[model samples]
Target: MKLLHTADWHIGRRLHGFDLTDEQGNAFEQIEAIAKKEQVDGIIIAGDLYDRRLPAESSVAMVNQMLQRLNLTDHFPVYAISGNHDSATRLATGTPWFKQTDLFLHTALSQAFKPVELADTQIFLCPYFEPFDAQQYFDDDSLQHLDQAFARVVDEMKKAFDPSKKHLLAAHFFAAGSSTTDSETNLTVGGLAAVPTDLLADFDYVALGHLHGKNALHMRQARYSGSPVKFSLSEAAQEKGVWIVDTDQTPVKLTFKTLTPIHDVKLLTDSFDHLIHSTDDPAIDHDDYFGITLTDTQPIPNVMARLREVFPKIVTLSRQDGFSTQVRYQGESGQQIRQKAPMTLLKDFYEQVAKEPLTPQQEKWAKTTLKQASEGGQPS
Candidate 1:
C-alpha cells in the first residue's frame, strides 16, 4: 500500500503579519499533483489543519476547497487528525458521516481505538490529547503525564493490532528526541508533552506532526512530514515537502517529494548601502520573505522604512555590529538611571533604537501613555 504523509498545513498561517493564503494554496495544489503522480492509495494529514483553533471565515473556506479537491474530486482517501491548535469540538461536527466519503478525521482520543483498516494496513488515527483527557477516558488517576497517558493508549491500541497486517500509527505530539523551532507552540507546561519513542516502536511506521521540520526526529520508524510552507523566519532554510511511504516491502520504503513555496523564506545579510543599491539588480527576487542582518556599525535613520522600500517582505531586522546606547549611560549608577523621569527614559530609548528623536505627536502620545500607566489605567 502506498500512502502520502503530510502535516501542519496551518492554512491560515502568516509570515510576520503578511498573509500566506496564496502560498498555502499553492502547496495544497502541489500535494494534489504529487498524489496523482505517485498514485498513492491514501493521504495522511497528521494534524494542525489550521493555524488557530478559531480560524477566520476565509481560512475555513480555503481548507474546505482544498479538502474537496483532494478527497471528493481526486478520489483519494484522506486520514486526518486535529492537533493542539485545532478545536476538536468544531472539527468533530460532521465527522460522523465523514468516513462515507473516505475522509477519516479523528478529533477525540477515543476515536483512535478503532483502526481504519485498508488493503494491507490498519491505521490508528491518534489526535492530539491532553493528560486529563486520557486520564478521564481510561479512569486511571495515575495518568499524570502525557507519556504515561500515551503508554496506556498505545497498549490499548496493541490489543486490536492484527499480526497478519501491517500496522501504522498517525499521531500529533512532540515525540522524545525531537528538536523544535520558534514556529511550534509548546504543547504542555514544564515539558510534559514529550512522548517516548519506545512506546511507538511497536507500530510498523509512525507518522508525526507538531514539529515543522521533517528532520526534527531521527528515528527509523517515525518521521515528521513538516509544515507545507515556512511559517516563521527560523524556518528560512528548511526544504518544505511531504513523505511517501510504500508498505509493499518488508520494511516500508520512505521517499520525500518536494513542494515549492510561492514565496520562499530567505535571510539576506549585508550593509544597508548594498541592499538599497541592489534594489535595481535583476538577480534578486525581492518578493520573497527576508530576514536582514545589517553589518553597519552605526544605527541608520529610518532603517526599516528604507529597507522595506526594496525588500517589501522583510520579516525581521537585526544589527550585527552590536550598536548600543548603553555606552552613554555606563558611568551612571543604577539608582541614578532609575531616577530619570519616565518620559525622559522613553525618549532616550526610542532615539537610541530608532536612530531618530521622537516627533512632537509621538512625544505627546508617549506622555499620555505614561500618565495613564502611572494612574493604573489602560492606554487608549
Candidate 2:
C-alpha cells in the first residue's frame, strides 16, 4: 500500500499574533496536489489537526473545507487522531456521521485496538492519552509512567494483532531519542514523558506525531511526518514536509517530499544602516515571515515600520545582550539570597524600589503584615 504520512497540521496556528490561515490554506492546496500527483492509497494524519481546543469558526470551516475536498470529493481515505492540543470529545463529535465517509477520526482509548484495513496494511490508531487515563482504563494503579501506559496499551493491541497482515501504528507521543523544539508543549512535567522505541517494534511502520520534525525520531521505519508549517522561531530552519511510504518493499520504502510554505519562516540579522539601504532587494520576499535580530546597541525608532517596508511579516525582534556570555556571581549570589530571611528580603526590596528605608512605624506594620500573610491571613 502506498500511503502519504503527515501530521501536526495545527490548522488555526499563528506565529506570534499573526494569523497563518492564508499560509495554511495554501499548504493544504499543495498537499491535495501532492496526494493527487502521487495517487496514494490513503493519507494518515497522526495528530494535532488543529492548534486549539475551541478553534475559531473560520478555522473550523478551513479544516472542514480541506477535509471535504480530500476525503469526500477527491475520494481518498484520510485517517486521523487527536493530539494533546485537541479536545478529543469535540473532534469525535461527528463520529457517527463521519463513519459514512472516507474519513476515520479516532479519539478515545476504546478506538485504539480497532484496525482500519487498507489493502494488505492494517493501521492501528493510538491517540494521545494521559498516564492517569491509561491507569484508570487498564484498572492498573501501577501505570504511573508514560512508558508503562504505552507498554500496557501495546500489549493489549498485540493480542488482537494479525501477524499475517502488514501492521502500521499511527500514534501521537514523545518517543525516546526524538529531538524536540520549543514549539511543542512539554508532554510531562519534571519526569520524562517518553516511550521506548522498541515498544513499537511489532509494527512495520510507526507513523508518529507530537514532536514537530519530520526526522525527529531519527529512525527509518518509525518516523514523524512533522508539522507541515513552522510554528515557532526555533523551527525557522527546519525543512518542513510530509513522508511518502511504499509498504510493498521488504523494508518499507520511505521518501521525504518537501512542501513549500506560502510565507517561509526565517531569521535575518543586520544593522539598521544595512536594512534600510536594502529595502528593494529583489531576492528577498517581503511577504515571508521573519525574526529580525538587530545588531545596533541602541534602540532605533520606527524600526519595525521601516523593516516592514522590506519584510512585512516580521514577528520577533531581539537583542544579543539578552543572552549572557558567562555565569556571573551564580553560587555566591544564590547562597546569599537563600540565607536571607523572607521578611528581610522583602524589606530590602521595598527600600531598593522606594529609594528609602522604612520608618520605624512603617517597619512595624510591614512585619505584622508579613507575619499575618505567613500564617495564612491570621494574626500571629
What is the overall TM-score of model 1 with all chains considered together? 0.86
- Each candidate structure's count of clashing pairs: 0, 0
Estimate the TM-score of every prediction.
Answer: 0.86, 0.82
Task: Give the per-residue lDDT of model 1 (tens digit) for 9-61.
Answer: 99888888999988998899899999999999999999999888999999989
The lDDT values for all models are 0.91, 0.84
Q: What is the lDDT of candidate 1?
A: 0.91
Instruction: Give the candidate number with the greatest TM-score.
Output: 1
Each prediction's RMSD to truth: 7.2, 10.3
